[model samples]
Target: MRLIHLKLAARNVRRQPHRTIALGGAVAFSALVMTLISGFVNGMDSAIQDNVTLYSGGHVLVSGYTVSWSGRLQSRFADEAVANIVQSAYPEIRTASPISQTRATVVFGSREVQLSLRGVDWGKDELYHSSLILSKGDWKSLAAPRTMLMSAQTAARFGLSTGDAVLVRLSTASGQQNVTDYTVAAIYDDGAAGGMSTAFVAFSDLTADLNMKEHEQQAIAIFLKNSTSAENAAQTITKALSEKGYTVSRGAAPTSGALSASSESFVSSVVGSGAAGTAATGTTTGTAAGSSGAGASRRAAAGTVTYYVSTVQELAGEISSALGSIRWIGYAVFALMLIVSATGISNSYRMVLLERTKEIGMLRCIGYKKKDVFSSFIAEGILLAGGAALVGVILGLPVGFGIGLVPFNPHGDFGTALVQGHLKFVPSIGQLALILVFVTIVAVAAVFLPAKKAADVVPVEALRKTA
Candidate 1:
């Protein structure tokens, strides 16, 4: 606590420039690595959370479930009445966006691709304006009837661009095969996972194409004013809907079919059914208006219903697991760096202890307490490690920024984690604090044994041995 102890510690550190520099340098390097790595990982995790939650999946997803032989999820078409009831009941919901989709074979010259024809209320969908990155063209261009947006990559692969026409082959909900040429309105890069190619159209156009009623939607996506409250909102909404006689069913959740479905498989359904060719086909049961099937009886069929409520975190479980794995890797890296830095620090203190043994004995003989010597040594270690860590952090900022300057588009499985599939370092105050605490503990621990050894020596014996 005295100025004398401070002066003595400074003298001891200056007495061995090389040893101090070696220990300090190790701490500096470790701190630099820690700062950059943690920042990078945080950046990547944030991107994925933002993009997936905002675009592909809402913070909470609401839809129906059906048990079908197909492993893939099938949409449970709900009437507009359901959406109205839910919204009126829960004003916590900002919007319950209606969306429907169906399989279609799109052809442009020799390049033929099977994709899902998605109908969205683009005018009301804020996600596109907020996070949708346009690779080319604009949403306004897709406004005309029979016009849709495609992935920038898909557009490139087909040698198609805005204003070009692509042929769509689909079977309407009316049980009719229809082939129509659609204009390419715009192209966007959905940099999230799955490399999904979605061409969106107005909700009205899709209903006309699918022969679906105006008040029906395959799924309803609920967006809340505060996204953090997604889980609670989903729970409340699900409970209210369940009370309305729409019981939840056990069924597989649907996949965004375009990216997952193969052209060959989807085309088989579209190609062979003129009688039931690859064209659109529709079906109706019961007797015709003026005819009967031999002996027909009128009996009402009982209806079955099921609902599935999920949060964005639950839907993106794989991504959460991956981020966890990345954190574990960071822990390993941090531990390894600390271990390596500690060894260097311990060795440096060991050398200082050996050289200062006689001096420590002399201090004890001059009425200085062993605790004083210990404090001095500990203080010296702090200056060496703490000062170095500060310097390292300062130096690391530019390096981290330099790395961020490069384009980081994480795609595929890892890529899906990105909000817009880009990476940038955003340092964590807590993580940095942990790093600093680590530096101090390791530094002080490294000095302990050596300082103890020096302080315990006998002064007269030490001088006799030196003489």
Candidate 2:
């Protein structure tokens, strides 16, 4: 009986092609808009995560800072010790490398620029090397001492090329001024880190220049097999480190600007000039890792090591907030569109009742029950909405792909949301299914009152009305 009603409803839907098309168009438009907006937000979130994982830090970052008895703070950790603990304790860690980071002024002739300089162990940094999209030169050159890799924008600004020597001046670990000459090894696209100059130098060269001892590094960037496991992995790793007699602190990730400013201040304070016992940018929280233990009180002993653990979500900083805002805006737009579609569907169904009055009377005269009449109308609504939404999803995927292909400025304000200078659209299958169901329900609900009213009509009264 239900199948019979659906068949009749399907025929009725086909009987008036123009009305069906016009009515279905609203639902279709809503679905298409929702698909594109959701895809864009998902893509932006993914791009930020990938960018931070590749360039700045990893899925998880572990850094340590120490306070001297004289009230000075130093952000440094024993690389070998921390690496061993990280790899052994967490099976999720796919790759971990200790990186030395500092802010330095690079001088090419008379022009000088302050940029974030990081020391990378390229030999073991397979993920970084593989993910880097180079515009010019080769990574092999980094094997040589005092060689650096610069972003294409920075390289262009400095008119630098492979083998061109540049001067980098930085403060050593002991607060002494030191200068080193480096040759440009490679230039990269600078996708996520665009507008900010970030350069990479050999670990050996940077450590030696910074006067760091053997196996000492500022932070260890850790990658996992699954990126989403970052927060859980951070907690697990923090617990392990704390149990291993290391003072651990849970810290929020820093934005690029905050990181740079903090690094500069940290370097300047190495000579005992900055605030006394101030925490570095990497360590924001004072609480012990994975516990509610006292934050600063945990650093009671002089020269006590404090390890800070953060995840990519934390490290994403302002970009994360921006992505969230875009997501909520997308939802608001989707809700508004749904409301508009619902209003249209309700009004159209009311008109449908008027046009189908004679048909409804004829069916009632043929012994059709009121429930059968109501079910038929509801089924028609479902078919129209579901079919329209399906078409919308099908059309939206290609439209999204086309939008992604349109090139935009990587240096723009929303550049961080782009992937490799292009907008990325990631449509989730689950999200699509939910959208279809939601649209079908709203559309069916809109027809509910009209369907019920049509079912309640007296057969003689309905038959009296002209078609």
CA lDDT scores, all candidates in order: 0.67, 0.78
**Cand. 1 Cα-lDDT:** 0.67
Best by lDDT: 2
Misplaced by over 4 Å in model 2 are 191-196, 253-299, 465-467
* Candidate 1 deviation (Cα RMSD): 9.1
Q: What TM-score fits each model?
A: 0.79, 0.88
Could you give candidate 2's per-residue lDDT for residues 242-267 as a string of tens digits? 67655567775222222233443333
Candidate 1: minimum summed lDDT over ten consecutive residues — where? 276-285
Weakest lDDT window of 10 consecutive positions for candidate 2 = 280-289
Q: Model 1: how far is 149 from its true place, Å?
A: 1.5
